[model samples]
Target chain A: MRSYKDIHNILLDRIKGGEWEPGALVPSEADLAREFGCTRVTVNRAMQALADSGLIERRRKAGTRVVQRMTRNAVFEIQLVRHEIEQRGGTYKYLLISRSEEKPPQKVRAEMGLSGDNALLHVISLHFADGAPYQLEDRWISLDTVTQARREPFDAISPNEWLLREIPYTNAEHVFRASRAEPMDAEFLNLGEGEPVFVIERTTWLSDAAVTHVRLVHPADSFRLVTRDQHGTAL
Target chain B: MRSYKDIHNILLDRIKGGEWEPGALVPSEADLAREFGCTRVTVNRAMQALADSGLIERRRKAGTRVVQRMTRNAVFEIQLVRHEIEQRGGTYKYLLISRSEEKPPQKVRAEMGLSGDNALLHVISLHFADGAPYQLEDRWISLDTVTQARREPFDAISPNEWLLREIPYTNAEHVFRASRAEPMDAEFLNLGEGEPVFVIERTTWLSDAAVTHVRLVHPADSFRLVTRDQHGTAL
Candidate 1:
């Protein structure tokens, strides 16, 4: 029986030595088992492990091959707003566009587990990094859960950063999608209405109580959204 | 004392009844305290809760104002491949492009935690759902881990679907980006180079060991990728 490491090394040698070149068919497991005098299961395990590691490709009956790509799998971390921009060597800026008191939107109410016409505090703003529009955040705050919100001027800071520090949200939900900007959105984002954008929507809770819901829009051409998982498991 | 539900209902009545309109500021906490005949903290709780629900907007020095929105968030769930094709009532087809055995490239090594020239099994494939061109999958597997890879044929079934059932992976990392497709990629995906494409790169790990890495390219105009989280938290 070949040691696990032995399987890894010998296979790697064949590939690197060009015995098995890119786009070339490989020998069958039966053949390898015959040549190495090992069990097919061991060969299967090694190959499965390799395929999992992104070293080679496997299919039902088509066989495995090499991948040539300009980009590999990249793990992305969700960033706090301030950190999101500073990492780019750009200054962060927040602008308060508008604010109001109104009934919660139906979807927001449903997501927050609120009954009909729940009063909500709504805030609209834009986030800029280095003088360029980075994100347009349109949000609704639950006046019922947060006390300090009444006295704050969002002009100097963002609700997200503030909530992270002062409020402890017990839960949250997030949604991501791609769409085009509208006419008003076009002007605000400095692009045409039909231009593509990346949109992220989030709802936070204070324990079982819903806290805040926000929709953030960013130019799709300019940025990418990233998330990482452990194979099938989320990171 | 007013029941929490009562507090929520009363506040909602005032907002929707136009007692507080969009862009119009809300009453002071002290005023609300007087009107509700509740303790300042109770009023605070209600207001805070409302803000959290996205029913209203809050600011530091600016107080609370009704929100005016230029955009509303839309959520889309990324669909599984099988569901995608069957939805169109088309028979899904799989084709093997190429397969080979070779040493892992330097970049692949860096990402996979391997040192020079590890043997690998590589495969490239085209997926057609409903008998039409759908996607192009480029993959790499480590020959060292799965020695049987030398013999597998991927013609009828996909490596992704196969691996999902046969091997359980512990971790995965994903990245989504927009890029212009090159000539070869365009030919495969049926798009011209410099045409925008939505690219997703994925890497999987089993426990601490790297298992597989894959790059899936989709024509941007062909379909949309979606993921959903219910709370403010990303799923």
Candidate 2:
């Protein structure tokens, strides 16, 4: 008596051996059961297992055929600057370069979905790992949504840390790109004027209200984002 | 007269207003119930909502306090080259540069966790969008695990597409970085020598057996990877 696992492995071998080409239909459960001297339920279980692994597709009456184009997903996590540095065995330091309440640039307002001439709290900060310039953070916090930000002094703690403790966002978007360092970014990150830099732009919202928008710039050679998936589960 | 949501917002305002600083314990449920003229259960529900959104921490005896460090998550999807190009409104094209079976380099072997003198199928290909070079794909398929790849000539279709349709991987790892293009990558990607390039390295396995490892390179100005999250759900 062959277990479903046995049938699964046997069918997997046959598929990998090219006995059935991609998009080609395989034997139905009833026929497979008869050939293997097993019940149709056992054969169905084996087929279902294969389908769940993305190897085959089963239609209502079209039977099972080898999948043609499989789409695999990869996930990357956005980490805090402090955590990223500490995880790399470096002492982390935060420096607040400037903080002011002003109307954000038109581009930023558009990105944050803010209409009207609303003033936001603008903050510029630098993060260091072992005394070396690591990340340049340009952040804007909405004073309308986070009213307490108006009275707070962000000199001691970074706005990122402050906001995380004070607000809970319901939506977030992240964009990762590579670009030549602008003058300000080059000056702060200690890089050549046109050196390549990796940039992450993030916008977060609390319900329908915008919370904050930030751009983190890092020296391209020193930073990378990694993520993994195991057993077909996204991480 | 306050509902859970009303209490939730009120508590949020007090926290944001710094009435209770981060790491500071707030009043207990009974106390908050008395203050808000609500049942303890209602207050508890409001507190639970705040905790669920990562705003506060509730301990058995330590009580609830504003959260100190909130770690957010971002997810990036690894898409097929053809699909990526098409999604950008360009005509996608694939060209096979070379294909051969050879012993992979030590670094690649280490990355794949292969410990023996194994010969793998190596493929070099270029992807074009709207008649311009878009990406360079350097891939190695373990002939030991993906035995059918040994006979498949990847001239008509990319090895990525062929393998996805033919095999199902149980695990995958992706690493994203920015690097200066090497000589071969420079030539294939049509970039100046040592120009910045965005790179993605991926390795996939079937169960515990390694199947393929690939490196994809693109011009820094042409490509980026974006991801999003909504309502606190990772996408």
Candidate 3:
């Protein structure tokens, strides 16, 4: 018997192959079931998978249609520094330049939604790929959320990898932009002052409580963010 | 009566609420069905939705578990330039700087996988938001894929919006990076030479044929890409 997964693949092929075409309302589940010589449940399962993948639009009353103006989504699973480097066949190294419990700056506080008298565990580190500077990391962990981080030895483990193992977060926001390398960034990344740098600011939350804020900087020529959709090939 | 969506919400709350916690194996579908007074199919539907949303991971033998290292995804609906500006309360304007049918540069040909003797429709345009230069777009459309574009009037409509309406593509790749504005870019964007510029290179494909390649450059301080997860508040 043809499984629902087979039907799902067939439907995806039709969408990508332009056989069904965009903005075309798909036949009802019952019709699909009859065509495939399967039950309505099997066809529904395939349709649901397509809908979840953002390939089709489904309505309770209006039925399902291929998205008119296809909005492609690039989904990326944020990975660890070590894993990211190792996956590219480069040896990974970590260096902790500074660690202290101090009051965050106004920008950090604003991003984390912290008010007066709030202090965070601020840590600055450098990550290396194949003995070259890869990323400059400036991170702040909420003392209220990860209390154990106060005494944690960051030299042995980067705060990012440590927190991933210790605390679980439910929400996050990522902002991507380009910036000129400041003096401090130039020194750390071994780049000239005013060189272009790719920047990413991530704020993670544990439900309603803000957990950590991190700023990662990379040499413009060295790093880029790529996202790929599963329905098609990525180049 | 409670539906699969109800079960999905309840399970998500438990995961995000820390009741189940990360890396914790969830109850089997049979158990969940019994508790919800429903069939295994209903519980399966809820579980499938959770897995699709990256809230949970499933394995045949190990069963389902709250993801240990939470990786979030940001989905963006690529919209028209006019809509993007109008939605932000800015008047949209378009200027076609240049349009010609010519041999594409080597880099573009390489990116598009085009061979010798093949020419493309090359277009350069500026998108303005509220009388300010918002984005500088350099685009190339494969004549083989979009033969109708040769005679199109780009002065009235932007090529990006035009292609989206004319041709439906199946695959795309987006590369986001930072660079210093060159002299030409500085003049076009009204920015100081060597200032940081946010660059996005997008290549779209239809089935196995490459359709278009575009590079969009924006002032770093003026634009940023924001991605948010569906389950949480957008910050």
Candidate 4:
């Protein structure tokens, strides 16, 4: 009996061999099963593996087709500030700079998918590694979804830590960019104004409800995100 | 019937409830199987789920334990620069700055795991979108492995596109960071010397043999990497 791995390799070879051109529809699972003399389930498994590897696209009604562009995913782990610092053998510290409930800026509101006139809990904080400023966090929490955050004081615990412990987010978006240090970042991260800084903006949601949107800034020379994959098929 | 998912949820609750403290060993698969009145295979599946979620660690002969740090992965798709520009509704252009076979810098050598005098094909190129400078690519191809590169003149096609079509790599690494533009970057990218830029360094290997190492620099204001996940369990 031909295993799924064998089918996967055979299909991969066909793709590499240009048997099906890019964007061209491949045979249906049922057709492929008959051609390979295997069960449909086995063919489906092989097709799913190809889809996951970014080589093919499968739609509900449309048949499976070769992807026009072969894109690969790079995975970066989102670590807690405390854990990141402690993992580097540095003592971690958190300090709250400011906290207020107000209508977030229009950009943030739109990014969080919030409507008009909704006040979110805005917070600014600094993370320290061994008494040196590390990251400056600017955050806006959706009080409508996380109602308990309104009553809790974030003096001891960061919103990041608290939210992770209290709420389970079903979706998240992360954006990475480079920008000049803002005044607040310059002061908190102890960097000269206009210096390059790495910024990570993240938004998390619990189902359809927005939970939090945060921007973490670090001095450019201090941090880098690295990921390694041992297998070609692994993301 | 106690499915793996049901067991997974119960174990997650136990971890959240502090039934097993961080770094504290949890019961082995055999023990948990007896308590839950299920087969060891079912319990093992649940434990694997927890481990994959960064909530637990499984060691050979040492049993399983709760993790001290909870980390989540953020996945960013690595798209071809040409595809990225085209996806944004711009005409993509490629310009070959220079190409030569020379001994790479010590840093490049170290990164590629090459010792002493290994002459590699160094290709510097610029990618443009709609007549605007987009990204500067500095690449080093291991001629030892990609021996055919020595005979090819990369005038009509970029090394990136050529290699992707020609070779298959089994392992890869990606690093993202920020940096001030060097003079070469400033001259090619039409940016100020001190301007901040987003940089991506990537290396690919065929099993243990290095294939290529590349650094891609983009103007800070023009590019940002974004990824969104709909499911909580996705990396």
lDDT winner among the candidates? 4
| iRMSD, per candidate, in listed order | 9.8, 3.6, 4.0, 2.7
> How high a TM-score does candidate 2 get?
0.75
What range of 10 consecutive residues in model 3 chain B has the weakest lDDT sum? B226-235
Computed on alpha carbons, the lDDT of every model, listed in order, comes to 0.66, 0.83, 0.85, 0.85
Question: How do the residues B1-235 of candidate 2 rate in per-residue lDDT, one tens digit apiece?
Answer: 8997899888887775667777888999999999999999889978876775566889988888987665755655556789888988999999999999999999889889898988999999999999988899999999999999988999999998888767767678888888788999999988888788888899998778899999998888998777777532313
Chain B structural similarity (TM-score) per candidate: 0.62, 0.74, 0.93, 0.79
- DockQ for all candidate structures vs. native: 0.12, 0.34, 0.50, 0.48
lDDT of 4 at B145: 84
Q: Is candidate 1 or candidate 4 better by lDDT?
A: 4
What's the true lDDT of residue B52 in model 4?
A: 58
If both were scored by DockQ, which would come out higher, candidate 1 or candidate 3?
3
| DockQ computed for model 1 against the true two-chain complex using alpha carbons | 0.12
Query: If both were scored by DockQ, which would come out higher, candidate 2 or candidate 3?
Result: 3
Ranking by TM-score: 3, 4, 2, 1
lDDT per residue (tens digit) for residues A1-235 in model 4: 8998899988877776568777889999999999989999889978877786677889977999987765667777778889888988999999999999989989998889987678899999989888988889999999988999998789999988888767666579989999999988898898999999999999998768899999999999988989886432533
**DockQ, cand. 3:** 0.50
Question: Against the correct fold, how does model 3 do in TM-score?
Answer: 0.90
Cα displacement (angstroms), candidate 2, residue A22, comes to 8.8
Instruction: Encode model 3's per-residue lDDT on B118-177: one tens digit a residue.
Output: 879889999999999989999999989888998897998999888887787767778889
